[model samples]
Target: MAILSSNYSLESTYSLESTYSLDSIGLHTGLIKCPNCGQFHSNAMAPHGHAVWADMPKDTVDLTQDLIKMGVYSSEVVDLAKTLTENQLKVSLSQFFRDSLFERSASRNRLILEQPDLEQPDYELNSSNLVDRLCLEVVQEAGGIQAAFAAAFGDRQGELFENTIKTGKFNRRQFLARVLTVAALIMLTNCQKDNTADLTSDSPNDLAQKLEKNQLKIGFMPVTCATPIIMSQPLGFYEKYGLKVELVKMQNWAQVRDAAIAGELDAYHMIAAMPLAISLGLGSARFPIKLASIENINGNAMTAAIKHKNKVKSAANLKGFTIAIPFIYSMNNLLLRYYLAAGGVNPDRDVKLVVLTPADMVIKLANGEIDAMMCPGPFNQTAVAEKLGFIHILSSEIWPGHPCCCLATGQPWIEENPTTFRALNKAIIDGCNYASQSQHRPEIARAIAAPEYLNQPESLVKAVLTGSFEDGLGNTHNVRDRIDFDPYPWKSFSYWITTQFQRWNLMPSNVDHEAIADEVFLTGLARHLAKKLGQTPPTVILRKEQLKYDQFDPTDPESYLQGQIKKHGF
Candidate 1:
């Protein structure tokens, strides 16, 4: 049995007819299943009583205890994101700042896992069929409640809605209801009129036509996961492709996201989850985002401060510890929780996670402010360089070839500037190919180690790039793929991410995960660039084998989420 569990309760109820304004945050209403009755309920169910969530109102969602525990290290950046999300501020504010804040606060009391919580709810539901129907009806119905009802059930809204008897799909149906209610409460949060002006593109015969915008601005953080993007600027890959690129090194993930959202950046290095979060309107709904290509694979590790090397040998010692991850909705959090759950440690009950940017992770670890951190790049290597931390496990050992970073851009930018997009993709593709070669890694290291780039010791940067580095236990290891660059955006990777969001309740409800993955992940761009570069792309796009978890099957996600999650699954 897993150590962590949730004392399951139902969701909060807000009046559907609440005074409407054009701008509102997400609707507070949601639905949960009754463990005893085996039926769905919209209000707080019995057995789990009403309680304050993270000291916030019950209407706001509550995170798992594992996330709550990490609240001790929460930063002000989170408040800014919430403010930006709940209400409009600057047009690009949400995308420009560092995402170092936890959306949740921690309870002062000891976290006890209860018998029931949010995990698998019998079966998966197709949200698109529902939301699309609702979104369309709302558009066609002319106005008011009739539009919402037509959108919800199309024809069966009042028939099934007013009845007391509930079916198995009732929980799924109710979620759409909440979405509709929220949609009604808030008329799209976008205050700015979208700019869809089309830019010039290539003539089929002249596929290599001049770009619409050649001067490109990109954003990055000083982490190892972004080696290709960072190295591209100095290695002349961008120049080789006839593009002048300026890499804006940002302080944190929030800033990276905000800048991208605000159009301050043409493209950026981002966590695999960040793009997904933005597309779902988790952080900001203003801009539709698209991922150009995956930037890295297996380029991270769980590093603990050197002082705790002896005291903290395994997951058991991590209880009551404050650990840090680069941001919310990231692979680091997924990997850490998997490790904890597999080791019989309840992440929510035993420890907490706080959001810290990759660079700050080294400083905080050294100061003993954070016991450990799962972060990307040179920061993990920097920790060993400074003798501040030791590597407990290379993230690859947990999930090999697991994606880390991506080359992502706002969707508006992609549509308006297709020619520029291809040029940028070609440059990025060329850089990825160059970085993949082991022989050139040392030179690549020297290029990115400039004061303007990573600004780290060349040797430290070289070690990670060349797959040879100190493991922080005094022994040197040559770890190939320690930090690698790959541009393929496998559907499996996207599907896998969707499962995690559902497992943790980061998403409102089940949507067409594969469809969304295909829409946002520009696999077509990778293929086009690969052909242009005379490189053969992978014949198979979906990953054939699972890495760390024997249970994770993207096709059958609930089997893993419900059966594998120690406390919440049951």
Candidate 2:
């Protein structure tokens, strides 16, 4: 059941009996009771498999667990464990890596350090070999059949090591050979793990640098909007890039915003407008937040309560109706306004817009507290699945390539830890690519639909992903872009958002939208991030700035704002 086995001596908890000696003459031979079995012995080697973790930290001990998850070996963990005769570069670190009391290094545990480079040795174990032999060998290496028994199999094997010592079969060569065999087995085992992907084609040392950072805390809402960010953890994207991130799920955008402002989170998913909102100080504290990539595109829908589905035939029918949006400064709100305006209903005057968390919106829609919501999926897909609501307008219909959730961080953090930011940027973009492929949608659904993660029905998530599902009106349809992912944070998309922010008067109209867009949406950062890591970053196909509907444009925003129906003045 343990993640690591077979003399997994890399454990942070281990203790071997310490021995001392006093001899006066041949008549006085040192004799002490074996602390292990309470039998008489000379050396203090009697504690027998107690707490001999020595100096290894729990994180160090648990390092191999990630290896098992990633299916790779940690050469760094090995280096920390012990340097054998083969490690010509470093001296015998036996004293440093011993079964003695020492404090585990605090700095080493925060970042998911790089998987070590284990030079595939002179010997290789093919896939056919089971590890039972390796296990027996490790049990023999503690040099005492008794100690090895206790360490490997527990206290059941009584005095076996002692009896073996008496038989004189215990040689230094055999002990050394066993240790090397066990270590080799650990390396080969890593190489054999399932999904043996070489995520970082770079050298192990290069990968180590790419993954350096403190314990990373990334905030996310348990919605499909944060799919790549959340799924990256379970999918090994984070580990591949050298980040040890704890995905903290927040209840609402407000909470996510608050945590980011307070520096409680290192990075997070944001509605495309959040970086601009945070930087302009439109919401809480004025933190200069910057976005590196757009995590998704057109992954949202406008849904109406089941009772109102027949009553609302089109956007114009939504006149005087109440609608919910997840955040005041959200792509949902802006896109909803665009869709509503095009339908001849003034979004600002004809309908009431309220902020609701995606989770809360579903309940409110079901309870009749809200008539409709321009929400993200799989919540949109969920509403349909529960028969609580039906999709009225897919966001893609409004602006086919509209940017939605983004991978954002405080501007200061990026400048301070460029390499670290670059590392994170690469991971998220990689995840975006993985999720973008249709072939991977089913697996992606399984990854994000787990209770600890999205906590939504897998079928709904899968439906949202594949763009094929029941529409809550008894009709079925397939729309491939129902919920899609792309990493480019286009400047034009920011311009569109900026115009909406102005049209809605969320902030002063006088601010420079283009300047703000350039700073907040750094597609350049996303592009250059990989190149910095010694890898050519993938060329981004930014959801083309082409506009199918003539209502919105990145340039010449004033005309679009003027043509809109009733607008906010706040």
Candidate 3:
């Protein structure tokens, strides 16, 4: 019996002059025939428990063939040997064979021991099927491999695994390697005990300990404006910062608002103005909600039915025609009203403004229930894709960098869970920075277009994010800045939204816009986090904004609103 060391190379062949008996080598007293030579050889066990021929062959191929004839054949073993030979890896064949056989035997024995009652008529008892069943059971127990990866590593790593699998980057061998690595990590995490002394300050365990709540439910509507919030889940931003977030899909803004107000959601995605309105108790019972960060900027667009392309080129032609706005508190409503008034069409009186959910907008326009819709993508883009509507104007065309949607959480929740809130804010801001890059748009579109998120066609979502699509007017446009993201919760945005709320008679005339803006915006926190993340946030809280027909001075919001009222003849 020979014992192979780690340095024993398979390239070197050795012939033993002395033969060992079966009892001395722990063999089964059998003579196995070499398939190639048609000669019977005494089989004996090596020191490492591998079957070895007493009279070994001089060639590696003949040794491999003999092993195969002795019932030690497995694709993995053969493939590994071939790979090692191709790569010139200095591994001993005997050691490799022993380790592979040991692992296989141990795995089979463990599974059989764990599931003793294996006499089912339909169940296959083969080792391959048993291993596959075990793997599936483990994955199911961990709520699928993606979720398990998220739990063991983070969301971003999980997303990488998902993409790798989806894009065929992982061949069978590479996939098995990754699965084994992730499984090992998951087992280690599960076996870890609570020991603060072993944890670093920035470790996930330490951060989780500091958080008031690690698990949270956040609400969002399936719109492109909620890109940062929606993409954060699938892209792994949330788990990157030590959070386990479950995104609850809401039907509309009203449902989102109600859920936030009812304390059913830990956080939510909302229009930029909703925190102010909710804080002021304008739309719902007064709830002190804080805008953690702006989710997206300039994603809204005005889309009109394709049939009205010639008849309704401008808002002036929209008089007496019914148009849809997602919600009264949304930027869609304010910007649409602003555009209509600029075109000498009073949105309130000259044209009927109806509140319709964005999800129903395209269908409503197609059915002739509404003439136009002012909403977010991919609904606007979906209209164009289905030939129901052509984009009349993008909000960016009206205001180049207008704030649209925001990430919000109740003030009380923030107060109780400040650490968790900061983590959540950082995750969302990271998502914003990621989505702000045009290169990531298509990947984001594919990620969020699944049934759990947007539930829209991938092409429609891709067109909206990539900003390259047909306009339903015999034109292909590539407007890269069509929808953009900025996480900074600018106070000027709040002031502008409040002014619009008052301009449309949604809020009282005497309300303190500046004070409400200061209370709800959380600009200081946004600035701090933005700077922490290596972003250049504005030095001041307010900045002047240029609109299509007018400009806004945040320092003199009242005067700006008065000028707007006078210009529109309000």
TM-score of each: 0.63, 0.62, 0.65
Arranged by lDDT, best first: 3, 2, 1
lDDT per residue as tens, model 1, 367-482: 88999999877788889988998998888888888889989988768656666676677777778888888999999889888899888889988888888999889989989888
Each model's lDDT comes to 0.61, 0.62, 0.68
Q: Which sequence of candidate numbers ranks them by TM-score, best first?
A: 3, 1, 2
Per-residue lDDT of model 2, residues 63-135, tens digit only: 2333334433344433322333223111111111221125265421111111212221111111111122322
Model 1 residue 211 distance off true place after TM-score fit, in angstroms: 0.8
**Please, what are the lDDT tens digits per residue for candidate 3 over residues 1-570?**
211123222221110100111112212333433211223444332234335556755343344345544544444333433332222111111222333446565443222222222111111121213333333332344466555334324444334334333333212233333222222222222222222122123666556775678899999989988899889888988777767889999988899888888889899999988888888998789988999899888888889998889997777888888999998888888898888889998887898888999878888999999999999999988898788999888899999989989999997677566667878888898889999999999999999999999999999998888888788888899988888888887677887888888899999999676678757877766765675677776645666688998878665678889998897797
lDDT of 2 at 37: 23
* Model 3 local distance difference test score: 0.68
The segments of candidate 2 whose C-alpha lies over 4 angstroms from its true place after superposition are 1-199, 202-206, 209-214, 530-548, 563-570
Return the top candidate by TM-score: 3
lDDT top scorer: 3
Please list the residue runs of candidate 3 whose C-alpha ends up more than 4 Å from where it truly belongs after superposition. Answer: 1-203
* Root mean square deviation (Cα) for candidate 3: 27.8
